[model samples]
Target: MPDPCSAIVHPCLPQNIFPLFAPRPWTLNTLHIIHRRAALARLLNPSLRLHAITYSPFSTTPLHISTPALLVCLAHPCLLGFSPLPAHPITTWHCQSPQSPPSPSRPPCCHACSPAPPPQVPVERWEEAQFTWEPFHQWVMNTSVYRRAVHRNYPMSYPCGVWANHFYKFVFIRNRKAASTTVTDNFDKCHYENSDPRLCIEVVSLNRLKERGVDPAVMWRDYFVFTTSRNPWSRAGSSYDYCSTKWARTDGPCRQPPFSAFSRDPSILGKISNLFHCFDRVGMYHDYYHTEPVAPCITTETGLPAVDYIIRYENLSSDLPEAVRIINQRRDPSLPPLPEPKIYWKKKGQAARSHEEQGVESNTAALVGHGDKYHKCGMQCVRDIYEYFRVDFELFKIPLPEADPAGDR
Candidate 1:
């Protein structure tokens, strides 16, 4: 068979004009070949009118290219030099029946050709294109308090809670008691150790970076910022359990208080409030767990969220991998998939027993040991906690536990 890319010369065209017709890559379809010939004919004789007959690839019927002089080129075989013909008048010819074999006087008919189908787009690519930032922008607009804070030009009073893995261009806003340790550990495993002594020793927040004269705006634009959020009530319960347990071992005033007592204790509450005021307060060494509201921690100096994505703790198992995949794809399309982080936490029974042995009746244990304490807290306590972290529940879309019609107490 002739190469599809080779040029076809027509006897009608002058030698000087024939050399100008360049070969184009095309398949051997009857209609395409006829169209090319028709185009050439038009270029050679601009006044000549032509009619092209097209056929389906499956049909064995032959097509005829008719000119103004009522001349028909049979199966377009003469153009391919398959048979002898007069040069000047473009002598017409005919093809034998499909059942008959080709004779010296006639050539086989050219098959009809259809254009190739377009390439398929990858599903991930489709998803990326369809994804929109509109919903997130709308959510930010709905947050009235956050909007006010941003508009009022108030300086962020608390640490911005951002942690960075410079090597991977990963930034995470740490929410106390929101599986921060798991997130930090996973990043450390995937990339080089964060060597800045301040961050090397502990997770650094965006505000901390600002205090050290490091501009967070650069990281905000340059890195992929992400953070995990837990339901506000559950986060509070976890904070109480983790912090009370830690402080109980030390000489702090909040030492060993059960959840119920701790929630009501004036001294502990005052200290917790003061800790928020003092941005330098470290949760590990202080009585406070650094339970800053989730909104403030994730918000940048400009009042916008510092991170690009928020991975909910409720769906962390699935969401974390997705976030990692998106980040990896953005950084390097050829990078291999990252292994999912293995998360392990103490069982409720073990946690309760450990706390009990430490001489404190775990409030978490008193309130269903394994479940959320939001439902177990009295109405007054719920209201107080809700009022305290109201912005977190509203901004993050963490639903409030349904109140019992008959008061919580």
Candidate 2:
């Protein structure tokens, strides 16, 4: 499609990108010898070969040819794909090849006496260096780990990292805005073969072990465990929007969802105050700071680590199906397979697509640091989110985005 250049190679990845093959250096004259259509293609797409082209007025080499050292795409290189040359490749060719004969190919203007002013601009162009917030924010959010789930019938989300149903022999561990709502709803309907499916409610880590004293190994051993993830940038954005937008509207007092027939179970259902925390800024943050944060729940620092599969939000269309197939195989055949978790979004969540309203997620958990209050999410937002969720990102092998000098306002 787009000449598969930057997409194929990048500055962060050097010669290591093509460890198997290497090419010999070719000079300026080599390019001109190519077929006419090929030259035309270079004229049409410069970055297709050179990321950016430069020229100097005092060079003896004809203005027509540039000897880099460039790429299939062009960017980081000495002159060719080969590295270990000058730290910074010459942006503008300064060679004065006196022995080389000027080709008839040199423009008629190349009257040796007064070569045309090095063409004001390269015939073809490449990168756009402008780094703004909105576009970058949007791009970061739509990625596999950063994608947010929102659509008609926005499933009610309950941010919990530990959830398990002994009856169904499955466990789920994840963070907020990761389709926990869909998993929770499906488990509610999946009960032991003959038991009351209506009362089949999954329990959080606190309830399963602390409150009910269930064995930790029960949830960890031989269970069809799974989890979900969204890009931290988008997850933070979704959390801010859903809690304040047309959905939960956390700006006001809000109540957690009631348990099923087990709603009356004092073991799973804690005190009324615990259930009805104010969703206001103070309330929501208090709830998160006090209750479920990503780390302490999912990290081995707090408990045993176990997960059979992870459903990434970005690949939901395909990932969900694969996870379902595996879970059904391990689960009891009589138990109806869990349905593909549903998704939901809000008016503001869809439009804002920004982090203007939130702060560093791990800050709420406060397990790592006390640095919080990043309300005006900007270029630094990606770095801040990654710092707190670094473990999760690394554990799943998600690539961290390069941070910019922009302040974390």
Per-residue lDDT of 1-409 in model 1, one digit per residue for the tens?
5332233344432332232233332221323323333433333333444554333321122233332211223223323311011011111222233354444433333222111111111112112333344543343344332443222112122333445655445566666665566667664432246443322323444445566564544544455666776666556665665554433233354344455554443124324433343213343223332444566666533233334555655445555666676556545434444556665332233444555676754433322332434446576666666666777766553455666788664
Error of 1 at 83 (Å): 62
Q: Rate the local accuracy (lDDT) of all candidates.
A: 0.43, 0.38
Task: Point to the candidate with the largest TM-score.
Answer: 1
**Top of the candidates by lDDT:** 1
Q: Candidate 2 on 67-127: residue-level lDDT in tens?
A: 3323445432221232212111111211134443444533332222112111111111100
What TM-score does structure 2 among the candidates reach? 0.40
- lDDT at residue 88 of model 2 (Cα atoms): 17
Runs in model 1 lying further than 4 Å from the true structure: 1-158, 189-218, 248-255, 258-261, 264-285, 301-303, 333-337, 346-376, 399-402, 407-409
| Model 2 weakest lDDT span, ten residues long | 118-127
Candidate 2: lDDT of 250? Answer: 32
